[model samples]
Target: MKLVLTQFKIELLRIFRNPYYVFWSLAMPIVFYFIFTRVISTGATDAVAWNKHYLMSMTSFSVMGSAIMTLGIRLVQERSQGWSTFMRITPLPGAIFFLGKMFGQMIMHLSSIICIFLAGYLISGVTMPVHLWIYCGLWILIASLPFLAVGTLVGCMKRVDTASGVSNALYLVMAILGGMWMPIDILPKLMQAIGKWLPSYRFGNGAWELVQGNPPKWEDILVLAGYFIVFMLISLYTRRRQEAI
Candidate 1:
């Protein structure tokens, strides 16, 4: 437990040291949210309908993108430097390393949520059910874990450049099809059908529901849990094979 916390602290410092995150992770979504709010708030009804759900979902996208893409790229870079191999030979338990990373991803989502909530509160008078905010925030974090695990497999299990290329390309494809760029309503039926399969789709919908003061349906949790299990198994199997080699 102590080792895990230590690793998590170190990983978090590395993430913050990037500096670029202050804009992309912290400020960009707030800017986008207010811009969208301004465009949509042309009337009284629109204002009435306006709340944190829309903004929160946007934050969710920001978290999903950052956790999957940024973390994925970092994982590959670290692996390429033989960091994973070195860790494997060290006193650090491999599970602790993965857990620390997963916790860092969760912390990233929490930070995004806080920034967006503050932006919405200050500018739009957007309010939320406090308990639901906590609830929904947790689900958003839960939904992201599998994608982080996916990054673990791709970045650590394969060549760094290939993993980076594949992860980014796949993120873009999933973002469009999964309605991260826009509401799923605007997507084609076939695309929406496919969105059901992508982790981000459920994340968006679950976040939307949470902001609306609704508990997530069981299936949202189920889908994310399933992905977590599947991806972790893949990563674990590959790690064992690498050891065998």
Candidate 2:
């Protein structure tokens, strides 16, 4: 128990201290939100609706980046620095180590969600029922699991440089295709078709629906779960292969 707590604390500190995590995961989303909603005003007819909808989009975007980029790169660096090997020889159980890291990531996700939510309220005067706020936050956090699995898969790469590049590519592609950058309704027909099938789109769709008083579609939950399973299986397989080398 103590070991898990200590490990969680260390992970938290490491995540927050990483400049990449701070800028990309935390700051960048808020900046983008401001730019889209405030600066390059589309003169949205329903400004409040667009503001609220985009809030969910940017929040999902931020959490996804944190899950796929920060966690993935850190795992690669740990392997290179011998941290993973050192931990293997320690008293820490493998499951506990994984749990600690996950809990830490969840904390980071929650913090990012709260910060972006606050920005929405303060800057754009976005408002919603208290229950809606809680639901949206929970939905975003839970929906991030598949991305975390993706990070794990990316972490399996041998080189940190390779992992970083791949993770960035995946992150940006998912964000754009998932409708996190703009509403899928406005995207080209082909992109809309592609985005609907993506986990990122499913992830954001849940929150967008929630804020509008609609329940998230069952397909969103099921698709994300399926992706999570597939990614985790592949990551496990890759890790085992690496270990056999």
Candidate 3:
């Protein structure tokens, strides 16, 4: 237990030390929220609804980005630099290491959710009931598990540069296609169909519905769960293959 706690602390410190966590996870989303809500569509019809909707969008966006880009790239670096091998040889139990890292990243995701929610409240004057706020935040954090699995899969890459590029591209493509950047309704009909199936869109859709006093659809929950199972299976396969080399 003590070793797990220590490893958790180390993971938190390591994550905070990465400038990308601050810039990409924290700062960029807030800036995008400000620009989209304040600058681009200051005159949006039903400004309150737009603000709330976009708040959920950006919060989901930040958490997803951190899960894929931050976690994935870091894992690749550790493996390439032989840190993963060193850890494997340590006395620390594998489950303990996994728990610590996963819990630490959960903290990171929670922080991003809080910061973006704060920006929505302070900067955009978006208001919601306390329960609704808590519900939406919790939903985003929970729905982000599949993306973390994607990160683990990306971690299987042997090269940091390759992982970095792949993760970045994956992050951007998912964000854009999933309707995190803009409303899926405005996109072409074909694109809208595709976005609805994407885990990213399903991720934000649940939170968006929550803020609007609707429960997330069963389809959304099922889709996310399916992706989580598939990604974790693939990640496990890749990791075992790497170990055999």
Task: Look at candidate 3 and give me any clashing residue pairs.
Answer: none
Q: Write the per-residue lDDT of candidate 2 for residues 1-245, one digit (tens) a residue.
A: 78878889988887787777778876899999999988898777999889999999999999999899888888899999999999999988988888888888999999999999999998789999999999999999999999999989988888999999999998999899999998888899999999999999999999999988998999999999999999999999998898996
Q: Tell me model 3's lDDT, rounded to 2 decimals.
A: 0.91
Indicate the TM-score of model 2: 0.97
lDDT of each: 0.75, 0.91, 0.91
Give lDDT tens digits, candidate 1, residues 1-245: 78877999998988878876777677777777777676654344455344565666667767876777777777878777888789989998877998888777778778887777777788778876687667766777667887777776775545667876887787778767877666777789998988877777777778777766677767777887788899889988887786797
Better of 1 and 3 by TM-score: 3
The candidate, 1 or 2, that scores higher on lDDT is 2
Range of the 10 consecutive residues with the lowest summed lDDT in candidate 2: 17-26
Where model 2 places Cα greater than 4 Å from the true spot, the runs are none
Error of 1 at 145 (Å): 1.8
Q: All predictions: root-mean-square deviation over Cα?
A: 2.5, 1.1, 1.0
**Candidate 3 lDDT by residue in tens digits, 100-204:** 778889999999999999989999899999999999999999999999999999988878889989998989888888999998888899988888899999999
Off by over 4 Å in 1: 40-45, 48-51
Off by over 4 Å in 3: none
